[model samples]
Target: MPLPVPDRLCDLPYAHLLTPHTGPLRSDERYDTVHFDGGEYTDQRAGGATFLECAFTGVALSGVKLRQARFNEVWAQAGRWVGCDLSESEWQDSAVTGGVLAGVSAHGSALRRTVFRGCKLEAVNLRAAVLRDVVFEDCLLRDVDFGDARLTDVSFPGTTLEEVRLRGARLSRADLRGAVSLGLPDGHQGLQGAVISSTQLLELAPQFAHALGITVKD
Candidate 1:
């Protein structure tokens, strides 16, 4: 068997012509090539389910158990998922736009080639997760935790990360060049492998200086 290519470029998801679906999201169920439009799947238990080539529009899911769920080639728009348990879930080639995810527990999740555009992720727990080639474009990630997580080739373009926790997180080629605000309340020790522009550095110099106990006299 050939070795796995780590640096291979990931292709974006194509337009899908899917079958309309109307049913409860059950555990261990596989939803393939289905479109969930204008559905309310709140307070449901869909642990260990697999969603492939699926699309969600205006879906509402609160306090849902989606642990160990698998998602591939999925597209979600304008979905409201609050306080959902999505820990240990794996997502590939997924795109979520204009979604509201608040107080979501998604720690230890693996997300590859995923894009979150114009989404609001407030107080989401993503500690110890592994993200590769993922982009957060024009998103608001406030109070999101990524402690001890491994991030590779992740870019946050046009995003504002407010009070985001990065303590003990590992970053490789993590680009924050286009982030409107990088609010790291945990200091800057875990950003050893990240790339930031000089302007950002200058803006954050005072914070880092305070953390290092260095006083600059003007």
Candidate 2:
């Protein structure tokens, strides 16, 4: 299954038409219709900023602080956001393609209509976050934490979730049917509102039985 392209790209402005964004980002500053191309920003702080209709291509962001930042109609591709502090941020109508986001602190964040395609997300902290209509297609999610999170209409198609933590997470219409691998370290209790395939359920029967204290003696 393929991921849907972001609608924001339909009205993408040309490079010359886009404003080049450089220098340090200020808090509460609103950036609209801007482009960040091949920029390397590390350890920068940009909390409480709002970005609308922006594009980030080949950008490298490491150890950056972007707490409470809002992203709308954003297209990010071929970017590396490692060790970023994105906690409490709000992302809407954004698409991240072929990006590598590792060791990100996105706890308590809210993401709506966001799609991650062909991206690698490792050790992302999404605890207590709220996600709606989010999809991970052809992506890799390893060591991701979803503790106390609320997910609605979230699906993982052609994605692998390895060593994910989901303790106390709430799911509604979360489709794991298309996942290549679903490795939930916190067990089935955290999958109460999720929808899985029959094959997946059979594979997890042992864990379910153990959770119920039902000893199955072969």
Candidate 3:
């Protein structure tokens, strides 16, 4: 099984003035094609909000809670997000590049046709999320949780996955050849159609044997 090539991101223009952040954000509001460049947002809560064709460049978000939000065709580059909660959010056709996301929780989110490149993800929780046609390249993911997530056509190249939890997560045509420290726990049964190198297979032999209920002989 091979990975599906995702569509290229389109450039969206900013047509509105820069709205200064002051208090709590509105829910179910449409942020129509706004551009956030070099902006800093703090303590904003935008649950169930929609961001269509928006671009976020060099933006910094701290203490933001966007639970169940929707981001369609958004491009976020060179941004930093700390302590943000995006649980159950829907991010479709989005590209997040060169970003540092620390302590962000996106548990049960849906990420379709998304690309996350050259980013540092620390303590990010994506448990039970739906990930389809996602590419995570050259990213450093530490303590990230992908438990029970459905991954289809997902590839992780040149990425460091340390302490990542992938229990019961399905993989369809996922390429992890260049990933480092990718240790699957014992009895992991969702590695079908996953591509890895010989070295990785050898390193994961113990877990594989355990999954097969095989006992090593002395």
Candidate 4:
């Protein structure tokens, strides 16, 4: 069953923050139009929390657990998340821009109409996540895993993917027109159903030929 949304924001602890708990902390909490800027949190457990129309700017979180949390119309800008676990979270109409998410686990999460721009993601696990109408622009992804993730209507513009794995991810309608990456597994990489101009294809023909060992005769 879905947890009930809280009426007020809970007071955050100040010191001795890195203890791991069994159950959810700050569960069923809700915040409407709340602002949290330049706050730092470490080793806190917050699962099944809900945020509505909240803004989190310049907040740094580390070793935080957020399972089954729901974020609707939230804006998180210039925040950093390190070693955080956000499995089974649901984000709708949210925007996360200019953040660094390192060693984060977002397995089985669902994002709809979400935008992540100019973010740095390293060693992030997004296994079995569902993304629809999501945009990732100017992001740096290193050692990120998106295995078995569902991607529909997703677009990545000017993103750099280094050592990232997308194995078994459904990307039939994903657009990666300006994404930079070495390659993918099983020869299923690159834009499949994305729209590109004729000039762009012409410019990439030689590179594609070199990769496929195709000889072009003049």
Which one wins on lDDT?
2
TM-score against truth, every candidate = 0.91, 0.94, 0.83, 0.76
Decoy 3 TM-score against native: 0.83
RMSD of 4: 8.0
Q: lDDT score, residue 71, model 1?
A: 91
> What TM-score does model 2 achieve against the real structure?
0.94
**Model 3: residues >4 Å from true position, as ranges?**
1-25, 185-189, 210-218
User: For residues 29-78, what per-residue lDDT tens digits would candidate 4 score against the true structure?
Assistant: 76555666677878877788887767677888899888888988667778
Query: Which residue pairs does candidate 4 place in steric collision?
Result: none
| Sequence-dependent TM-score of model 1 | 0.91
lDDT of 1 by residue, 90-152 (tens): 999888888999999999999998989889999999999999999998999999999999999
lDDT of model 4 at residue 109? 97
| Candidate 1, lDDT over the whole model | 0.88
Q: Ten consecutive residues with minimal summed lDDT in candidate 4? A: 11-20
Model 1 weakest 10-residue run by lDDT: 1-10
lDDT of 3 by residue, 1-218 (tens): 22232323233333343343334457787886676777788888788999887777788999888999999877788899999999999998888989999999999999988889899999998989998888888899888888888888888888988877777788887778878668554234567667888998888888888877899998
Position 193, candidate 3: lDDT: 65
> What are the lDDT scores of the predictions, listed in order?
0.88, 0.89, 0.80, 0.73
Worst 10 residues of 2 by lDDT: 1-10
CA error at residue 104 for candidate 1, angstroms: 0.5
